[model samples]
Target chain A: MSELAMHEIDRLKENLAERAAAEGLIDVSYRLVDSPVGQLMLAATGRGIVRVAFAAEDFDAVLDSLAEKVGVRVLHRAAPLDAAAMQLDEYFAHARTGFELNLDHRLSSGYRLEVQLALPRIEYGHTASYKAMAAVTGRPAAVRAVGTACATNPLPILVPCHRVLRSDGSLGGYLGGLDAKRALLSLEQDPFGN
Target chain B: MRLHGVKMKTNPPFELVVREHGPAVLRMCTALLRPGPDAQDAWSETFLAALRAYPGLEPGANVQAWLITIARRKAIDSLRARHPVPVDSLPEQAAPIDGFGPDGLFENAGLWDALGTLTELQRKVIGYHYLLGFPYAEIPGFLGGSAASLRRAAADGIKSLRKLLDVSEES
Candidate 1:
């Protein structure tokens, strides 16, 4: 009934993936990340983590957007994202307080990109007002711009954009919706916030 | 951003497609290419190539046929690069995969060695019929014969194989 042993063929596919990575044929590799917030689509270019998408963002649309913005060559190979996935799990477990991986903000631009760049500096378990975030981006008058920046933050949790709030100390708009905002903010305050 | 009504057709999840059809493609390659290492290389390249372009495949397309088409092309590539086909020897099968059936078509154990006695066309016809189960109606486009002739070709090929294999054992 069979002329081929599938296990050997599966081993060949693994070798093919590693060889593809080694040959630099991969433009962007991605994997779905499970977190306290929700399912996230994490994509990375050779540079770094390029995009982190909320489940509501529609994984297929996010991937298509990525294929358009990044190179068309993309695949689901979890190997490259293992370290980042581990850090995310630890962050959710309150065992970690910082993301040490490099980032690629190719999907963001102008004031938004500037805001995204400044987000990681907000510190863990702390909140910064929109005015404060705008100030950090050197556009103190761009408070609304700061809110837009947070709303459009591509790499949300990893970039610490959740730490930005309203000028009145209220949780502001989050790309992943308000409940996810609360979960993340509360998760940060836990002593497990290692 | 939400993309509810995008009108373009894209491939289904590429990983799912790969897992679902990989073994079938591998069997096709093994049946066509005969030699083990060559078959493995062809199988690897086939999926690697598929992964490269899978995102562009149409949603309603026949996935099995598409994969089989690619597998066949890779097998042909291996076939062409293979300098001289194995006219003798085991061609690396060594033992039949999953062992010979109870029907004694493979009782003597050197199936691949017997396969080496077959002509390339005979082997291809026999494999497409018996190993992969592609209907004879669809094979003439690739193998160049009517469905009846293709079936006869397969039958004749297997008859030649039994004679070749049985004589070897008696000797």
Candidate 2:
């Protein structure tokens, strides 16, 4: 497309996004935010932030999942995600230790929700074992389930799933992959359960 | 690794759908109506409507055709809203075509006027067949005309458009 055509179409899309959002036509709004780990695709519902996806997860696939799992009225507007994006930027800069944003946990439920909800209490610069997390959730025998919760955490950083580790203190699996897990843990200056 | 090679029937993200088809839909809207607020509204309405109904659409469906169908409907609705009385055809206008207005959208005012001079059916045929390149056979299903008749309409529309554009250029 020519520059003039591109400008006109962008104006049209911006107008559409605003009007659709005001009229209650937007079901999911999303924007991409940069982080120490990589570019993150943040998507939210009317309730709160829903999914924060890594670039490696394939943004197109992530959006498809959002459309299928949430609502199909997905748009690329940054208004709803501005607070979350700003906070994330602050966190990456080591200026913020915790999130003050509303989160939508519709993507997880039951034991997963229980496990994820307990993660924030782990504190910055501290790691918790899956076995310990299971015990904290009152399911000491479901250490594997705790691992599953961390592995499939719909909201990764904000929920702090990277804090969960193996009983031996080895890095466990993470939804954003183990490398991202290491990057986030080091960024927090993880003292390894100290 | 075993499952990586398997073919999945995943629906494309709606974002991709909009990115790929948005420009064409906007162009179609402007051609169907004049490029301005009304045309922009029709483009937005078409996408919103498409997004609402997109999940139910078949995976093998022709996306462009589906979008153009929606665009046409939204454009007609816009026309209806602007004119209270049923506008079967546009009345002949004797006013000289204006040059570009303050709004950037009016840059193509002459072309828009030339398009406006074509009859509704002729305009539809020319826009769909020549501008957007919808095949004659495919157009009948949406526009409700025989392929033979549509071909004739397009020919006549093209002739009139050429004459109008030539006159505008000379003056």
Q: Which residue runs does candidate 2 get wrong by more than 4 Å?
A: A190-194, B1-13, B36-38, B52-62, B79-125, B128-171
Residue A173 in candidate 2 has what lDDT?
89
Q: Which candidate's lDDT is highest? A: 2
Show pairs that collide, candidate 1: A94-A192
Task: Supply the global lDDT for candidate 1.
Answer: 0.72
Q: Report how far off residue B95 is in candidate 2 (Å).
A: 31
lDDT of 1 at A144: 93
TM-score for candidate 1: 0.66
CA shift at A162, candidate 2, in angstroms?
0.7
Candidate 1 stretches with Cα past 4 Å from truth are: A1-13, B1-40, B50-70, B80-123, B126-151, B155-171
| lDDT of each candidate versus the true structure | 0.72, 0.76
| Residue-level error in angstroms, candidate 2, position A80 | 0.7
Candidates in order, TM-scores: namely: 0.66, 0.73
lDDT tens readout by residue for model 1, A33-60? 7888889888888989998889988887
